[model samples]
Target: MADRLTGQPFTTRSEIIAQHGMAATSQPLATQVAIDILKQGGNAIDAAIAANALLGLVEPTGSGIGGDLFAIIWDAQSQQLFGLNGSGRSPISLPLNYFSQQKLTAIPAFGPLSVSTPGTVDAWYEMHQKFGSLSMATLFQPTIDYAEQGFPMTETISIEMALSAKHLQGFPNFAQTYMPNGMTPTKGTLFKNPHLANTLKHIAKYGRNGFYKGDIAKTISRYMKDNGGFLNEEDLSQHKSEWVTPISTHYRGFDVWELPPNGQGIAVLQILNMLEQHDISRMGFGSEALIHTVIETIKLVYEDRAKFYCDPDFNHIPIKTLLSKDYAQKRNALIHYKANLQVGSGMSGSHHIGQNLSALNHGDTVYLTTADKQGNMVSLIQSNYRGMGSGMTPTNLGFVLQNRGQLFSLHPQDHNVYQPNKRPFNTIIPAFVTQNDKPWLSFGVMGGPVQPQMQVQILMNLIDFKMNLQEAGDAPRFLHAGTSQPTGKKMTQGGYISLESGFSASVMQGLIDRGHDIQDLSGEFGGYQAIAWNDKKQVYFGASESRKDGQASGY
Candidate 1:
């Protein structure tokens, strides 16, 4: 039995009936939305769509209708995983020549130019048309109600909004919508977004067309034209989310799955492949040796991402070659047992030798996971690129546009150079692990570029060190910013790693001795949500990060 806060058996592990289907997310309202959908006899897709819609309302900064979405859906009946790529492409009118003519180095911060095709609504409709068993009206009611009626402000939402308040100052619509009185809403305050409510009502009535081709589109395009943005009606009308196959790799006795190029899923697979070379279980959980190995692997994968990963439509990602076991083995062999080398120093024969990785700080992304009684599962992640995204809110739209275009390189000759209709490099990566063709876990971490690193470490903690879902997510983490040539050949700033509250002082000291710059973090790093199926007991156990105000609930 699990003990309660007061030492009473508030709920027994045995008394808890394992409803084969469950839902968990970074916001309680979103979780409730999924649960409500399930109770209304909706399938996994319906519940997931419902939850996702509500998340945009409850956690506006983390995600919104204006952002991109990615998902890996497991069809329990078909025994296959399907990938949904809802990321938007650049505007057709945004030509390469335009940048040259304007002498623009990079995409602007906000207004209309920063907006992509806005495929999120279209993607949600696509998923529903193919897999959902509920009416679009039913799926959207929860979100509409939350927006119209009101919801209590959560501390996590409050703190993040407050931190990014400066960015919000520039956009009048954003200020009026989120910080109505020009003040951050305190926790427990009842916040309502009538504009968003009207928007949701429009979506529910006209399907995705409501947003893509009707009044909403006209309103948005008009706002962009009036405010120096580049988006137009054609960009919105031509957008369509693609359904692609997910990439997978076997680890130990399980098959790990993630989405393809344009996402950092391959990086997650690469990190796992590298760690598979050693008997990480023997290192013990939270041990310095294990932590060191994980950190080093993260550095390698992130280096690859910074140098190579981009939209598959634009660049050949070489995912198959990179994730192959043979390649991982070759890369893993370079790690020296006793010393930590500077980032990019361990690459054996890679050509891009001298390039330095940037120390860019990112904010705002949302993650959610779901499973149905029929065994259907989905691990979904979405983001607006930055908080209040680009800080450009269209008048009366009740949402901020994403600044994803900032991810593109400014150099005209670079492969990731800014171009019209090109999707920028993205950091949102959602993952799943299965044993014998059955999903054992569906999980994700919400952060900017740090997502892949966090996912890899959590997987290691669970599969390698045999920790529970909570423990794995609760473990201390380290991030390698890679080498920067700001000063000289001195490996930029090597360590600057983040250690969670639970790590021992000795472990921290060991990392310091290993030439790592360490920093102590207090619950400000990231949020993880997971659903692990206990095969033996035939029950599903869900855990949400305690660092955030989230909940894991099951029916």
Candidate 2:
């Protein structure tokens, strides 16, 4: 019997596996844009920008110009690593007293009050200014064309839009802009956003100011002010993305690097550190032992993240102490060979040390990985907190604003307290692994609070289990959702671990035996994309998540 969905003949694995220059992503058009840029002799940065711009057009609900950006770039020539902190700060008008006066317990859900100044466009410009050969205008042309002329609605985009449509219906501008005719466009239907096209055009012509200080900013601020929102002209004018040095640790013979603070990259490094002592290969891939070790390591790292990780500017993140070999050894010592340890019981060393760590808020983000012909590589991640970002589409800008402000803790005593002009805690971490001094792979995953867990699994698959980039990304995964205490009493239900379909039944039973409440997921836990540099082949190979409706293509 024929498969009713895909009418055409399905290609065999032998044929599909023979394809070259792989590029994996969450959307088809974004992958094509990267392939086009690579074909045109552009490097990784250029290709990444091209792809990222197109993602804003096609996958508007996930990411766009109105968001923060972060990246870990590996320069092959100088053998130096660079980090871009494209996160935006809170509005100066957002005083702590404002929330107090309004008697608000937490930040608003989706509105102007929840919005933050977007830093993605300027971040792209800054990255191009420092490393790209192609003009910024050229990088944006593909995206502008897609936005103005229209592009086909993809299965992933359509589904995500429809599922989240309820949150989007309240904002008339967003509805009119994205759903125009009072209906979500079906897959393969042509979708265009003229307002976004004009916005991109202004950026191409006038540079980054096209959105920050000019007409676009004015329109956004005006809309927010009139709508009982906190974002103002001052927020737009004050927004600036920074460049920071990346934090790294050596595992086996490879060096893994990730951005500091704001991002949860340090947590990923910590997980690797905890698992470093175990010969996971000896446990055999996907064995109960291997899964247990991996899950235990994730719990240790995430426990620290919940306790201590936040914006470094606002809180003292002991990055060096956390990633140090001594800390890893101490945490690794808690792993028992026979069974899974309870969450609170897993804490080693002084209990006072654990008190310093506090749980922070998470945000929605996108991740992109690229490797150019010249060996330059980029692991990029960006976000607007959630789908359609606060659900506020200011009159002519054509982009939804990010709700980063919601990441702030409403409590004044909290380390991540909502403060004027302070950045929020973000989960958008990108990672790179290097052999010797050369970049070996660029990878990242998109999930609100699942990033650290997903990253650790990918690293384990590649570093510990010896799998390739595609296999590592395609492998089944699990996440131990961290817990939050409202009144110093730990909430155990939040500690429930989620497992994907491919995990072994033995592993599931083992987790259950250890007192973990287990939940099953239908393989859509997280979306991951990765690129590996093959020194022998002298070409880049990319892999996109099979669970997602996107592909990876390279030229």
Candidate 3:
């Protein structure tokens, strides 16, 4: 039996990681590396970057050099929250005319055509340049070592790799990199990628130039040409991570912040605002009424998401109109608890906007949270879009290019229609919560649309149900997915609700009686990681998901 550390009856899966610093990530080694960085006097930014880089190497099924990134960092000194939109843009060379010419109604989810210019390396360097204490080379050393010498394959990674093989085996270099022995490695097998190590080493030595330019860029260019993909060196060289202000909505006095679109963080705010309209606490956790309210809110907000959320650089999104309390008040009236759920975007004199239930991709991202002694906290999420990405592996890169372009709509009138150099609609988001202008929590969940769904439930658990960070994370969750699927499928009426175990039979029956489409989902809720600060005590608490091979630790 383990000796309990805290005297206050150390309860729940969350640990009191306080005093100095703490780090929680989807990989145990990455978590340790982050804590080690904190101990070495690196700040939260450096610790987060260190862990995230390792995730790219170890959890390549989820994230990698070929994917995109998003982060919300709480600057303890400035008392200001910052957001980074690290998502990549579509190929400048790929025009809307091409899709129209091909008569394709949807962006292909796999193959070279789906590839976007990867932005993760730029994100790592940008944050580090702004806030890191450790040198770039030093921050990436742990991942480099793991990649070259190999780290033991986790059961989750092995499962994902095997699942991906059938879909990705024929893609170039994928077999050479991930299936070197003509098969996915079994759990605990020592998996090494010297090629990935070399790629990482190049960037560490040369900084951003190493990735966005030079040999790395050329290799990606060649791969694109050979595969008929349109992303070119210009797209790679022109890429820059944007520093944006975080958007927030007050929920029960706590301010929940998310990055502005093209990522779906705003959806997190919208759902929260709708829930705040009613006394969620009065309904209680897992109650049919609460579940129904949550589901109906999601259905409405996601209808708005599909209609208007897009790359702001290309489309003028009415952020002020979308986040307004008046808008939420109007939307909240549509939630008839007793009626069958048939939802759509409410008319806003607002952006005149108009909205699937396809398979929601899961388990393709690594979410991490880190805090430093200085009070800086980071909530970061990185992903390859879907497990193993587009199956378009550049030779010797040891990572698959992201298929983010798949989120684009083929409809010309759609705000999210694919265009040259535009970012597609993004799902990966990192979140922060502040109370009384002080950093309260930094957290995120992994899984496509499930990211926002999990965010709402996690915040509600903490705020409404008074659950600790660990308990909030460990609690069974429900996913109401009626949003347009990335596969271009139509959103279903009364979108199916996937409930995890623990709800009472009566609650399930109650939902059914209310005309809810109920189903059981085994493990697709999300993998959560979060860090909460006890401002009075000057300490932090960290929690890692029970569903993932992850850890939360501090010194």
Candidate 4:
């Protein structure tokens, strides 16, 4: 297959092309903000930070300062990629004994117990210190202005706000900040948060200290203490983003890189490794054979994910062994024409694979990609777990604390079991593709487990099927939900598969005939945004998800 000259039925629009720079984000305003930063003499890193700050203000339903951040950057100067793990840890003061003492089987989805130390602000500062061209104040000014002056809520965000308001209104400051006048903002409503502006101003002037060591930290600690939470000033102050070496797997001569454990990114690499065994292109896109192989591969990889993916500091992960081609081949051999509902971890031994599980769906998140004239590109993702997060808004903070800690398993023997000061198993990850040691693409799909599944599909679409950047993102995707997660959930029913509306009835029937359970679940497929570098053309290509209020623009 080759790149199509005519439009494919799935493509929403042609790829945005430009020589100087390009950006793709979930929100149009954020994309414009990135472009503006690039035009203002800022590098890709600076532009990404600026756009993320603005997103925190305008798209708080998904991302905010209260969430965690992860990024993969293609540094033009070094000609190498960098990975940043900006995820936060559970409070050291919160002991596992407390949960056991309370007789709680699982952490509550919302409220104080789920909140963790926020790491987004520190991650921004760290990325800036290493690669930023503009001052922190300059990068933050646009968001601060928008926060105080107000910005129009997008259609999707407004509906999400109303939903969040219903669940989080009881939390301190949530109603005041998001539900002004006792109601959530509707589409086109000009929402303003002067308090968030003040907070951003503090960060602009004092850097990470503004949030981790100063008034913001103190306020968060006080609120948690009074509200039956365990996070404190110490947890905030001790937080630091780690600069990690990105790991990769070669697929069809392309090096696909993702961060190590504590995030589910490697699941993409695992799926791809297993997929490399089959000539999927021959099976054809959306064919029953292709879908079945991918789905079965996912189930096998997720079993390993549930058992091994965790905070590296707490347990040693066999990163090398797990990503081995031999292991992938062994796993791939298990796939057949039919679905396999009864799967177990490939490696022996047992931790409590979760007895009860909640399908992580519609995880509110933001993913954006940017490339500048200097040839630098950034793939960044940020999120407040679930919807608007833990619903434990600190008084006057104007943001919700992330419920990421809810991902930690209560099972004592699990590697991802709840532990004080340990980072939870993260769902958000940034991805990159390099061809022959040069940056080729910076992209990400935003949702929980939907991420790795989409990542593999995107890669296959581009490499195996030869789709253009936009077409790859816009193509019909299959979401494999209910797989065992790091939360120790077991897959007793083999889980189910959800396909986008674009799939043909023949494909659906084929999958069902193969013993695969197919469901019509829309809006849970995850949002995608990507930027691909065309070295020969000396230009960039960008694509944004049509399912979202997204934009892919260049200049």
Local distance difference test scores for all models: 0.76, 0.74, 0.85, 0.90
Q: What's model 3's lDDT at 374? A: 88
Best by TM-score: 4
What digit string (tens of lDDT, one per residue) describes model 3 on residues 30-107? 999999999988999999999999998888888998999999988877889889999999998888889878887677
lDDT of 2 by residue, 345-425 (tens): 233332221111122223345678777666788888877877668888899777888887776667655556678888877
Ranking by TM-score: 4, 3, 1, 2
lDDT of 4 by residue, 1-555 (tens): 333564576645678999999989999999999999999999999999999998888889889999999999999999999999999999999999888888988888899999888989999999999999899999888988899899898998888888877888998888888888899889998999988899988888887898999899999999999999999999999999999999999999999999998999999999999999999999999888899999999999999999999999999999998999999989988988788978878898766876637446657899999999999999999999888899988888778899999899898999999999999999899999999998899999987867899999999999999988988888889988778878877765878899987778898988888888887677787889999999998999999978788899989
TM-score (C-alpha, index-matched) for candidate 4: 0.98
Task: Show where candidate 3 strays beyond 4 Å.
Answer: 1-14, 348-357, 485-488
Root-mean-square deviation of each candidate, in angstroms?
Answer: 4.0, 4.7, 3.0, 1.7
* Error at 202, model 3, angstroms: 0.9
TM-scores of the models, in the given order? 0.91, 0.90, 0.95, 0.98
Candidate 1 residues 357-432, lDDT tens each?
3433455788888888888888888878776576777777777777777666655544455677887777788888
- In candidate 1, list every pair of residues with a backbone clash: 90-421, 112-229, 113-230, 495-517, 496-517
Residue 458 miss distance in model 4 (angstroms): 0.8
Q: Say which prediction, candidate 1 or candidate 3, comes out ahead on TM-score.
A: 3
Superposed model 1: Cα runs more than 4 Å off: 1-17, 96-113, 338-359, 482-495, 520-524
Backbone collisions counted per model:
5, 9, 2, 1
Residue 10, candidate 3: C-alpha displacement in angstroms? 16
